[model samples]
Every structure is written in C-alpha cells, then in structure tokens.
Target chain A: MSGFDVGGRLKQLRMQRDLSQRELAKRAGVTNSTISLIEQNSVSPSVSSLKKILDALPVTISEFFAGEEVSREQVFYRASELTEIGDGVLSWRLIGARRPNRRMSILHERYPPGADTGEDMLEHDGEEGGVIISGTIELTVNGEVQLLTAGDAYYFDSRLPHRFRNVSDSECIIVSANNPPSFSDGGDAQHHA
Target chain B: MSGFDVGGRLKQLRMQRDLSQRELAKRAGVTNSTISLIEQNSVSPSVSSLKKILDALPVTISEFFAGEEVSREQVFYRASELTEIGDGVLSWRLIGARRPNRRMSILHERYPPGADTGEDMLEHDGEEGGVIISGTIELTVNGEVQLLTAGDAYYFDSRLPHRFRNVSDSECIIVSANNPPSFSDGGDAQHHA
Candidate 1:
C-alpha cells in the first residue's frame, strides 16, 4: 500500500484507541497538523515519525499494518503474487499483499553479485530470522560479520544494527521473516558504490 | 521436539540468562524441584506450568522452542521434512525443523471434520496470525466466534483465550505463523466428541 493509505490506517488506530488527533499528536511529540496531514494523505510521515505515532498508540508496527485494509480475503499467494518491495540490486518479494491482521512479514529476498546494503546500517524494533535458500550472503549484525551459505540461517533482535550483502559472485536467495514490520522503504539499502 | 528436548532448551535459556534454578523457581512461583525436574527431563511440564517458567525467564514459548537444537543448518524443508508435532485429527507440519535460532514457528495445520480444540481454551503469550488455505474452520477469540473459510485470515494476541475447530464437513487446512513460539504438543487441541 502507499503512504496515503497508511494515513487512513493510522487514523483508524488512533480512533480505535479513542484518542483525538490533537491528543495523539501531543502524546507522540508531533504537532496536531502533522497528524492531520498524515491522516488526510496530504503528507507522508517518515519512518521515525510513524514509529513515534505507533509507540504512542502502544501498537507494534506489524499490528498497525495488519489493521489496514481489512477487506482482502486472498490467501496462499503465488510467487507472481508476491509484492516487489525492493529497488536496486536487491529484490524483495513480500508475501500476502494488503493482508489484514498480519503479525509477521515473510519475505523472499534476492541479492545479485556485489550487492551491498549501503553505508547506513539498519536499526529497528522486533525480531528477524532468515534462512539462506541459495548461494551466499554476508550478514553483519552489530559489526559481527558472518558469511552464510545455502542452508545457513540467522535469528537476531532487530534493534541491533545490521546489514546484508552478496559477497559471492553468484546471486543469493533468502527466505526471511520479521515481526513488527518495517516502515522504511523496501529498498532503503544504499549501494556501496 | 519432545518434552525431554524442551528440558534441555529451558536449561540453556536459564544459563544464557545467568539465572540459577532456585532463582527461576522463585520467580515462577513454583518449587525448585519443579524447575529441576523440568530441566532434568524427569517431569513434563503442563502448558500452564511451562508458561509460568517462561514468563519468569521473560522469554516467549516460541523463543524457547527456537533455541532448541541450534546446531542444525538445514533449510528449505520439504513436505516430508516438516516436523510432525500434532496428534489426533489435528495435524501440524512445522517448517524449517532443526534450523538454528528461529524467531517464528510457521505451521501447516490440518484439521479433519468434527475436530475441536477440547473444552479448555488455549492461552499463551505472543501474537498469532493464520490464513485459511482450504475448507473452513471456526475460530473463537475471547468469546467472539468467527467461521473463516478459504482465503479468510485472523490475527490476534496469543494471550487472549482462544480455540479452533474444523466446523465444516470437509477437512480444513491453514497456514499459520506465531511469534514467541508455542510450546505445547501441536495437537493439544482436545476433541470434544
């Protein structure tokens, strides 16, 4: 879904919690206009801003996304149905698009040779685990680097700074699942070059 | 994994947290013997007892199970490779068995007609979500009941009292994922008839 839709979901959650826009904005340390703008789809809230708003609601990011667009009934998404969430050399296929009430996001991710996850490391709440399905990838969690090949898996708290890159000459594929969902753009990974 | 295996995992977690057995018992409100017996595989803990012990550790059941047998490097489990954790009419196939350090438990669950989750409701920690892959099932959360058919999905906090049954005549299949992991035998679903 687009950022515009995220606004409506935020509004729904705010109302469900019986908090007015002004009250929520105050609790979230954001301005009432910011909340209003987000709800009206006039502006897209940044990931940090959205995190603050969700924290004030006492809801996880995954729950917030799960509460959006409850009308969908499609299940068992085929490979073609996976939503493409990444840009650059990283290709991320997110299972179940517009799935309501999602607690975890299952991703089929692919990284081509020489792919790097930019310079800025990723830090988020919740937990993440993945299994390398093919080829090899270099996973760095809080500066602890591990070169994981096919069949190698990892589980870690997402709050730790982490990055992934394809160190091998061949392509790498991984199936990963994470909770609380990530609010950043799928391709937040910057190219090392 | 069996109850004996759970004991080893519990011990590992306790050590990892650097908590003495006596201290853990005190925190869980159970006797030291209970903790000792559980850790030694001399006694199998009930679901409730296990919850208390896990809560004392501040770890979810999912995390506990995920911690067990961390040495394996197998990934991409085939249908036959799925671990069978269920008994009776409710069959559950767990993905990525023996894969180290998992954060989530994904289950391919099937329930034959007339199968019910017993008289006692199931309550645990974490969050759960599932999609009805085929047939129909009745899901009760708290006290609200919903009959979900193919393509329908549900997500809720696992602490809430909930139960499931195959209310339809045909068999039902669901692809479910839960966090903090469930510790009971997959088929703890008691049949009413």
Candidate 2:
C-alpha cells in the first residue's frame, strides 16, 4: 500500500474503533508520539513494534500485510518499497506505490496464530467487504460468531460490533476493503467532528 | 493496480456508465457475445479491442494494465502491459489496485491535445480530489472554469456538473480520486427503493 495512503487508512481504522490517539497509545502500550509518527509516515515501525500495536487493536500482523489494486496499465513495485503499517502480528501493506486518492483501500492482513482483535468488538460507519485469503478466522459480528476459511467472503455494515480471532494453529491471511480508508496518523484529533 | 481486483472494477465501471453488455457492444462496435464474455472474465480483451472500448468510455488503456497485484511483497508491472484506453489523445491508469475498497478511486489520467470527456458536464454524488501530474487541464465545474497545471490540486463535490478538457498541445496527466467507489456495474439500478 502507498505510505501516503496509509495515513488515511490508519485514520479510518482508528475512527472506526473510536480511538483517540492518546487512547490508542495507552492501549497499544506505546507512546503517543510513536503512534503519531507512525501514522504520519515519518517513522516506519519495526515488525515487533507493529505487532504490539495490532495486538492492542486486536488485529493480527499477518492480516495487515495483504493489500490490492487494479491499474489501467502494468506498473512495477519493489519489495523494498512495500508500505508497512501496524504492528508485527498485525502488519499491513498497501499494494500500489503511485496511487493517489484511490476510492477504496485494499489491505493484506496477517493474523498470527492465537492473535485476535481481543475480546472487544469493533464497530464503525460505512461498509466492509472481505475475503479470507488463507487460514481460518473466527469472526463475531453483532453477537454471532462465524468461522470462515479460505475463499469465504463476508460483507457487513461496519457500524455493527465485530471482532476477529484466529483459532487455528497456522496464520491467517485476509484481503479486505473498507469503503473509506481507516488508518490515520494521530494528527488533528481536535479537528474531527 | 492489482489484476486480482479487476473483476470488481470492471463490474463497477460498466454499472457506473449504465451500459449493458449489448449496449456496450453496440457502442464499441463489437459483438454482444464478446462483451458478455469479457465481463464474465471468460475472455480478456486484446489491446486493440480493449482500447477501442475504453476510448468509448473515455478511459485510457493504461488503467486496465496498471491495476494488477503480482506478488506478496511488491507490485511489478511493465509498460508493455499498458492497455491503451484512449485514442492516443488521453490516457489514464487507476491506482490503489490493492486497496479497492478505499473511500475513493484514484485515477492517473493523461489528456492529449483536444481530448475531453466529449459530453456534457457530469454531476454525481461524492467528493472529487485531484492533483495535476503534468501539463494542463481545463476543468469546468458547473459554470466555473479553471486552468490547472502540474503541481496544482483540486477538490470539489461531484454533484456539481464537471468536465475536463485538454487545451494544450501536450499531454496532461491527472491523479484523481473519488469517495465511495462511485462507479458501479448498474446492479444498483435493478433495485427498487
């Protein structure tokens, strides 16, 4: 994923979870400045650091690495240039480099074995569509738990409370899209309505 | 752009244009069966044919080629793979192939001499944001016309009628995005409120 794009995604995710920067920092076991810098793309988090944050968000690192895009023409991106977001077990990558203002942000997410969004469910506005690329995910939405395997797709209103966990021993990979980019750097919190 | 995501995009664009398989085939001067096959992903449009159809839509061929995800680490696309969408008069590519579910879709549009939307201004829902990658674009939103050159940016409500035309002799590329993935495959039309 584009680093520039990650700022928006991070903001979106944070908002979806109704997390203030300070709140997220406190829960993720990180400093407010660390989250702020990471969200601003000023500092790229180490895999371990990212994992801790995802652990706090309850998102897995493996699920964070998967992202996607479709271009009119073929373009090339190098591995060294992958846009990394979140913590280790819940790291993510934006698929394209030069994408500017894309309507939707796709993400490749890696959920480590036993890692999850924790006991808390997350709810937000807009719509969410996702497909499990690999492994197994135990999804609880609106008080119902659904176990999804590879190739399974689920779409729901983001406003509904939800949580994801990996019950399998192996890791899980999921390809997902949010109607609005959700991740953001901790900036302009007071400015948000 | 990620090829894996193209299936949804093709469906979305066809819907947004409000052109059916038969209608699109008629507009592109192709057989209806061919359109059906392509939409189904049963057949890939050749360079020339794809270009002709996209030109009718006024989208550049580069978009078709540029939006594909190749691997887990980085995006790798080649120039040779660019699908020609415009008639050498305008070119465009979609960014954020990995993050198709983003709030807006970003497009890299190149306008050649005398290229324009060739229709009345368009008014739609959502917000439009763009940056001029190079050259110039004569943009008319409602009754207001603005000349945008490289490094210039624009943001506007899409509900205002808008159109873009290249008044310069050289090609102009624009990086643009709109929220809510406004383009659709006409599936929504079938629903009755």
Report the lDDT tens digits of candidate 1 across residue range B1-193: 2313767778877886788999999998888898898887776675456757877866544344432232324333444555776776788766554534444676667799988886688876556666565798888877778888765566666666778988779999766667645633344532211
Candidate 2's docking class is incorrect
lDDT (10s digit) by residue, model 2, range A98-117: 34433344455678888777
Candidate 1: list runs displaced more than 4 Å: A1-72, A183-193, B1-103, B106-177, B183-193
Q: TM-score winner among the candidates?
A: 1
lDDT by residue (tens digit), candidate 2, B34-143: 76666666655543455456656544333333323322221222233322334465665433334433333434466888888756777665555555547888887767
Rate residue B49 of model 1 by lDDT.
66
Instruction: Note the Cα lDDT for every prediction shown.
Output: 0.65, 0.55
DockQ numbers for every candidate? 0.03, 0.03
